[model samples]
Target chain A: MSQKTILNDSHRALGAKMVDFGGWDMPLSYGSQIEEHHAVRRDAGMFDVSHMTVVDLAGARTREFLRHLLANNVDKLKAPGKALYSCMLDETGGVIDDLIVYFLEEAFFRVVVNAATRDKDLAWIRSQAAAFDVAVTERPELAMIAVQGPNARARVATLLSPEVAAKALKIGKFVAFEGDGLFIARTGYTGEDGFEIIVPEGEAVALWQRLVDAGVAPAGLGARDTLRLEAGMNLYGQDMDESVTPWEAALAWTVSLDEGRAFIGREALEQQRAAGVPREMIGLVMDEKGVLRHGQKVLTEAGDGEILSGTFSPTLGKAIAFARVPAGAGSSLRVDIRGREVPVRIARIPFVRDGKPFDAA
Target chain B: MSEIPGDLKFMKSHEWARVEDNGTVTVGISEHAQGLLGDLVYVELPNVGDTAQAGQAAAVVESVKAASDVYSPVSGEIVAVNEALADKPETINEDAYGDGWIFVVKLTNREELEELLDPDAYAEAIENEED
Candidate 1:
């Protein structure tokens, strides 16, 4: 049997089409996916992100444990409620999972990982924490909802207590605030200004309903996928997996090899950096009419590559994708779709950013 | 949900074909097929005069989640392809039985039409598949 989120009933009640997404029974869409995509781009939308795993690390050595575990440096988060995006890799430098780690206090920190990598991530974190004495506790009792868009923060603030609302409003990007059993973070997967609220699982449905009543449109996985792709965010298994390394997957910026940090896979990354990485991930936009899709063969003068993630951008009214190609691949390439070679331009990572088209295109 | 008009013949793959008095069959993916596909973003249709065999891929429908192949229900030569889908593929989601019609095929063998399911039998076939 597939695992269902706490909002499964609410999704069905709203006429959402449910699908099995990486073992979690989740809503794929409520109605028109394009409309849902536009809602987040133009107005406000909410997503039930309860399926993602939240693990709290608590102990005197929590910070030190994370420093040795993550590819990105946790030392950058000096202040409480600050979050860092990092990838945890294995000894071979293959990405185990990409996650957001929130630094709360010296003894407590929160890590949100992908839903499909929950079990393996917990196991890996626990095993690595053996020497640090940190305790890893999965918070399955907490439910997460992401309210994103231009007006997302304002709409959610209307439902919060005055003090909490003030704190949320004042919170900067990539920051979080906790109050009254609610953890509100100014973070989101979509390239939109919003908050990802984590509340008690029992109170989640009611909060979701309140958001719905506040004119926050309920979106599903379909819109979420398109939004994330437009933002150039990587999907766990599709963009990179156990077989792929962070440096080759266009995540070299997330890796910290500055010094004094001996994290897992550091040596391997250093070695790979010394020896030039084989494949580099790039963004591709079809100049003509065609939808870029995963597994499509990318033809470059240097060598051939394949698309990692692709979709039609409702915001841009065009198709875009991230493709892994030869390191020397030029800025222009062709994609073979159903035996037709279509010209594609090798643009920068994000086709759109900050509610506008990325300047690279 | 709207009724499946009796005059239309159906394919097991969820394509509805309405045989015009002129012997050409208008083809469109069924409402059930479109509903299952969620929202279509891109559609690749066969060109006019292309030969399509039964069970062969005749068109491509891409949704936000994944791409699916629309199979030819009956063998024939493509008479017309919906050019409107090039700009508005979501028409399949809006009117799978009407404006979203994919193409028209001039039947090469009218006798092969007997292999297709009628509207009522098509509904039953779909229900059984769901079960």
Candidate 2:
């Protein structure tokens, strides 16, 4: 048996095809997944991302705890409602999970982590928080809805209170505001202007219906995957796991090494940086027709590599993927699809931004 | 439920076979199969002169979600392939029974056709599988 979200019945009522994702009975799509993918790129689309775990940490040393907890420095979050994307690292510099940390108050901070890593993440956070005297609490009574696309923010604005609506829409990226019994954040996995609203579990159904009434097309996990892949966003388990490091996972920028903070995995990262990272992640695109799938062998001048997360981009009408390879791998690359050696080009990712194509990895 | 043409036969793997007047079998995935594999982006068809073995994967169909193999319904030499699907794979989702026919195979074993499920039996199989 799998866990279900507050909107499970609502999804079935709307004719969704359900699949087990991360032990949650999540909707894969309502109808045509390609059309759902287009809904996010061309107009507004809503995703029931309630499977994501919400955790609250409150204490006098909460801020101190996070600074030592995450690879990205929490000192950058000066103002309230500011959020930062960071990777939680293990003792040996391997990535445990990637999450968002929001500073809502001086002593109260919120973190959202992947559903599949919830148990281990909670255990790790708790074990680390014990020494800092921080109270770590999991908030299971909340649900998340990601409304994405060009018209997303404006479309969602019509449903909020006049006072909260103004500020929520005006908030900068990576910023969140709590209002009207909802937490609205100007951040999304899709490369679109949108809001990831965290609503009360009890009101989630009504909010979903309201968003539908506002013409926000109800998309599902299928569209979410394609949109994020096109946007050059990394999926947690596929792109990077506990055995992988941030430097090799195309997440070096998220690491802040300038500070004197002796965060976990700091020494291992420093040594790896000095020794030259062994592997690197790159984006690949196939000019010909064929889907590049995970675990596909990639041929490069330097050595062989493997695809991490690969998907067909509805926006580009082409196949795109992320491959992990030797750091010295050159521009020339080929992927083995069955028995055929198909050539692929390395594009600078963010293949699509602002709902348009840009030549990229 | 998808249309189960009484004139065609089906395999448990969701492929359908229609015996043509030319003594060849036209093979394609069922409408139910196409519906499950939404928005196909690519299809790898068997060669025109290739030999297809019954129950063996002869072609590949890929949607955004994943890739699936289209098994040959009966052993035969491939007579023709749907070359159009390489450029436009969505044809399978659009017309899995007509223009989406994957390949045509000249029967090498007429006895194998008898092993395939008829329209009524195929429909019942789908219902049981769905259940």
Candidate 3:
């Protein structure tokens, strides 16, 4: 049986189409997916993201443990509530999962990881934390809701207490605030201004009801995927995996090479950097009719590659995809759609931003 | 619930057929199929002279989520296709029965249409699927 979130009953009551997503019963859409996508891009939308795993690390050696665990240096997060996006890699420099870490204190750091890789990540963290004496605790009693879009923050603020709203307004981008048994972060996967709020499981239904009554449209995993893709955010399993490195996944910026911090996967990355990287991820956009799909072979002048993540971008009104190609591949490429070799142009990472085409903006 | 046109024939796979006055059969997917597929972004129709076998894949419809096959409800030779769908595929979502007809086929075996489901049987099929 698939696991259910706290909002499962509510989703069913709202007439959502439920599907098994990564072993969890989650809502795929409330109704028309395109309408939900437009709701987030133009107005406000909310998503039930409680399926993601949240782990709390508490101990004197928490920061020390994280310094050696993550590819991104956590020392840069000087502020208490600041958050950093990083990838947990294996010893051979392959990505295990991309996650977000919030530094609440020297001894109390919180990390949120992908739902599909939760058990593996927990086991890895526990085994690695043996030497550092960090206590790893999985907080399953918390429910997360991500309200996103241009007016998301404002609409959500209307439901919070005045004092909490004031504090939330002051929370900088990539930062979070906690009060009244709620943690509100001014961050989201969609390339829009919003808040991702985590609350006690008991309070989840009431909070979701209030948000729905406040005119926040309920979007689902369908819109969430399109929004994140349009934002140039990579899906964990599709874009990168245990066999793929951050350099090939177009996530080299997330890796921090401090002079003295010997993180896991550092040696392999260093060796790969000395030797030239072979494959690179690039964006492909097709203005024509057909949609670009995953597993489609990409033929480049240098070599043959395959599409990692492909979809029809709702915001851009075109097909967009991320393909792994030879490092020396030219800007022009062709995708074998069924049997036809269709020409595609290489574009920048983000196809759309702020409800407009990124290239046009 | 999606509308089921009583005057037309339907296959369990969700393709609908209407026998035209010219003895050619007009084909399109049902409203339930379009709703399940979401907003279609592309439609690939069969060639004008291709032979379509009953219960075989004849066309392709793609939405943002994934691609789905549109099966032939009866054996026929493709006579004409709605070429407008190549540019404006959303017509299927708007009107799955009227302006969204996929193609017209000259029936090679008229007896195959009798083997397909009637409106009541198709409705029952959709109802049983829900359970």
Candidate 4:
């Protein structure tokens, strides 16, 4: 049997097609996956992200703990409610998981991690915190909903109290605010203006219905994948894993190489940089009819490569993919589709942004 | 609930066959198959002159989620292929029974048609899958 979210009954009531995702019973789509993809690009769409694990760290050394825990420096986050995207790395520089850290105060910080990696992430954090004297608490009582699109903020505004709405709507990008019994963050995986609202578990269903009443379509994991892919975001296991380092995952920007701050995996990263990283990730586009898919072999002048994540872009009406290849590979590339060598162009990522074509990979 | 015409025959793999007046069989995947595959992004039809054996994988249908093999329902020579689907694969999702017909086969052995499931049996098979 698979674990289920609190919104399981709600998804079934709305006629969703459910699938087992990473050992969790989750909605694949309510009806049409394509329409759901368009809904997030053209208007507002909400996703049940409650499967993600939420951890709270509180202690005098909590800030110091995060500074040593993440690849990205936490000292850069000076303002309260500010959020940072970072990758937790193993000692060897392999990514354990990528997560979001919210700095609410010096002694209190909130971290949201991937659902599939919850068990290992918790164990890793606990093991690391043993010597830091910080308290690590998991909050399974909260449910998360991400409402994303151009009109997402406005649509969600009408559902909140005026005071909360004002504060939430005014929250800067990459920021979060706790109000009206909810933790509203102006951050989203989709390349749109929206909020990832975390509500009490009991109030989740009501909040979902209210969002639906406000014309926010209930999108499922299918749309969520395409939306994030189009936004040039990497899926954890697909794009990178325990064998992939941040340098090869196109996440070097997320790593903060402070002068004196020694974080885990810094030595490996430094060695990789000095030795010239062997692999690099690139964005691919096939404008023709063929669909680029994961595991498809890529033909590059430097050598052979493989696609990490691939999908059909609804906004661009083209097939897009992310591939890991030799660092010396040129822009010219071809994807092998069922024994057919199809020509593909290397495009800058974020294939579609703000419901428009933004080909900056 | 998709319409499963009484005049057509089906395979357990979710492909339907219609025996035409010219002793040829028009083949297409059932609506249930299309629905499970989601919105198709590409379709690879069998060549017009290709020969196929019953239950053999003959064509390919690709949706955004994954790729699926469309098996031949009966042994025959491919007489016609749906060239339109190469440019617009969503037609299979829109009209799986009508314009979405994948190919027409000139049956080399008519006796094989007798082995296919009728509409009643096909419907029951689908129900059994749900159970």
lDDT of each: 0.91, 0.93, 0.92, 0.91
Give the TM-score (vs. native) of candidate 1: 0.98
Residues B1-131 of candidate 1: C-alpha lDDT, one tens digit per residue: 46888888888889888889999988889999888888788899999999988778899998877788888877899999999999899898888988999989898888778988998899999899889
Best candidate (score: TM-score): 2
True contacts kept of each: 0.58, 0.95, 0.89, 0.79
**Given candidate 4, what's the lDDT at residue A327?**
89
Report the C-alpha lDDT of model 4 over A121-162, residue by residue, as the tens digit.
999999998889989999999999999988899999998899
Candidate 3 chain A least-lDDT 10 residues: A352-361
Quality class of the docking in candidate 3, CAPRI style: high
lDDT against true structure, model 3: 0.92
Model 4 residue B126 distance off true place after TM-score fit, in angstroms: 2.1
Model 2 steric clash pairs: A347-A360, A347-A361, A348-A360, A348-A361
Question: What C-alpha lDDT, on a 0 to 100 scale, does residue A32 get in candidate 2?
Answer: 91
List model 1 lDDT by residue over A67-116, tens digit each.
Answer: 99999999999999999999999999999999999999999999999999
Of all native A–B interface contacts, model 4 reproduces a fraction of: 0.79
- Candidate 1 residue A349 Cα shift, in angstroms, is 2.1
Candidate 2 CAPRI grade = high
Q: Could you give the interface RMSD of each candidate, to one decimal? A: 1.3, 0.7, 0.9, 0.9
The CA-based lDDT of model 2 is what?
Answer: 0.93
Which stretches of candidate 4 lie above 4 Å from their native place? none
At residue A246, give the lDDT of candidate 4: 94
